[model samples]
Target: MYDHRKLGRELGLFDTDPLIGAGLPYWLPDGAVVRHSLEDYIRTVERRAGYQHVYSPALGKRALYEISGHWAHYDEDMYPPMDVGGEQVVLRPSLCPHHAVMYRSRSHSYRELPLRMAELGAMYRSELSGVLGGLTRVRCIHLNDAHIFCTLDQVADEAAAALALIGSAYRAMGITDARYRLSLPGAGGKYVAAPDMWARASKILGEVLDRAGVPYEAVEGEAAFYGPKIDIQVGDHAGRESTLSTVQVDFHQPEQFDLHYIGADGARHRPVMVHRSIIGSVERAVAHLIEQHGGAFPAWLAPVQVAVLPISDAQEATAARLRDRCLDADLRVRILSAQDGSLGARVRETRLVPYQFVIGPAEADDDAVAVRLRDGRRLPALPAGDVIARVRALVQAHDTRLWD
Candidate 1:
């Protein structure tokens, strides 16, 4: 099993200090690069899927949660309220209520039956220090969170599309062993108050998953108080399971919030809501990636993709030129020619990085580079253009684990 904390430090990803408080993360420069890349990738996918990006505040009025039913059902997980002027305010624990407010901001028609809104939302939960583990569990989290406002007629199709998006993201991350659990409220389960409504909602979600051909396990009584969900779970190297993504069908919130839209029959109707997160939390995903690859990330996601080395000070200029070329190609490149070391010693150091480009008099004169791939293969000489092209291709493919 991989030691995630050790790997995180060694890779210069993130750290926790006593002064920074527990269950909080301070991302280093390298760690931020990975996080930013992930956000960009997810945002691009969401944009293509018709999601409109929006921002909501971190703090909300206490009554917001009360209206959303979170105050009644999940108050223990929330932070205590503070007096902002005469009114009480609480740090927002979830984004759904805020999204609902946004939905209420404007009138809607059946013509816009499906409206998708996404946010790289920052959320806070009062987690106990004991449960906090590096980036996996933190008080401050950025979620790849989104909400789909759809008519009852459009819910199934929209749900399937959301599932497809999550699957594509997992595949892009090279994780293939993920499992899906179709969560349903139990007849006598924790929050099952209406058995008939629960049965109908469960059947609808099951039919949607079935029609989509999504293999899933039915989990009875595993849903939240408000609704059923489809959870995406993945096991870590230690055989421990974690939820990586979720798609929830909520029937209660819309009614509670009195959200409505004009239908084809010219009547006000409550729209159904679907909540999704392809990567549930940014911090959790980072932690999982650290363990999954054992600190060696793919080229596109690596903090530092290439380290350029010169045999000696005499080759510094040539190495700098190669580094510039790589930078121009938008590759993360590092220079390691400060110390007087043998080429073999330098190569060992370069191993710390995913890719290495070695330049010396012979290759510099030939307008070529000696490439050392991550898998211990050394191409003695290759045209500089060819090497750059290959590296770009590999980066595009997200082949960061190893050259092989």
Candidate 2:
């Protein structure tokens, strides 16, 4: 079992200290590179799917969640509201409330019924210290969250599409062990007091799973307060299961926020909200990737995609030149010169790097580099331009291979 907490520290990916508090691990430089790449990939995918991105403040007026029903049901997991200029405000625990307000900010026509809004936004949760271990549970989280506002008639198709999107993202990230779950409302005061709404939402999610022809377990007591959701579950090295993605059908928030759109008949109609998250929280997603890959991430997600190693001082100048060209090509690269250590030692040090470009005296004179893959495969020394272009193509395509 590869524990992320162990690999994270050994790889210098993230750190948690007493001063920073528990459940608040800060990302190191390498970890930030992985996160930035993941964020960029998600943005591109969402944009291609027609989602409009936005940014909202992390703090919200208490009334915001109150209107969204968090104040009434989910206050236990929320931070205490602070009085600001005689008005109380709180760190948002979720982004749906703010997105609801954004949707209400303008009148919309039915043509735009399925309006998709996405945000790689930050939110805070007041998790108990005991349950907080590494990134799986955290006080602060940046969620790849999005909400789709559509008509009742559009709910089924929109929910189905969201499920398809989640599956596609999982496959791209090389996550193959995830299972589907139908999370329904269980007996609790945590759920909203809308039985009809719960029934409708649960039915829609169950059908979505069935229509998609995926096997899933219908579990009670695991749903969000406002709605039932399709949870994408993955197990860790310790066999502990956690949710990594979700697609939820929400009819309650729209009613709470009075969100509406104009129909062809020119009458006002309430919109249904479909909540979806592709990778859930960035921290947990990276943590899972660390364990899944055992710190040897896919080439596209590797923190340092390439490391240039000069066998001797004779090759340092050529190595630096190659590094500059890689940087110019927008590749994540670093030069590991002979001064650091022997060629073999340097190669072993950056073994996790996807590609190690070793510049020997012969290769430098020939204006080429010998490529060493992370998995111990080797490619003959080739022209610097060929290596750079191929690596750029691999990264841009999100390809898993080191070369063709």
Listed in order, each prediction's TM-score against the native is 0.93, 0.97
lDDT of 1 by residue, 54-165 (tens): 9999999999999988888778889999998999999999999999999999999978879999999888999998888788779998999999999988888888888888
lDDT string, candidate 2, 289-383, tens digits: 98899888888899899999998898888988998999999998989888999888998899999999999888988889899998889999899
Pairs that collide in candidate 2 are none
Q: For model 1, what is the alpha-carbon lDDT of residue 190?
A: 41
CA displacement after TM-score superposition, residue 298 of candidate 2 (Å) = 1.1
RMSD of each candidate relative to the true structure: 2.2, 1.3
Cα misplacement distance, residue 259 of candidate 1 (Å): 1.5
Q: Model 1 — TM-score against the truth?
A: 0.93
lDDT value, residue 279 of candidate 1: 79
Best by lDDT: 2
Error of 2 at 224 (Å): 0.9
> In model 1, which runs have C-alpha deviations exceeding 4 angstroms?
186-192, 212-214, 338-340, 397-404
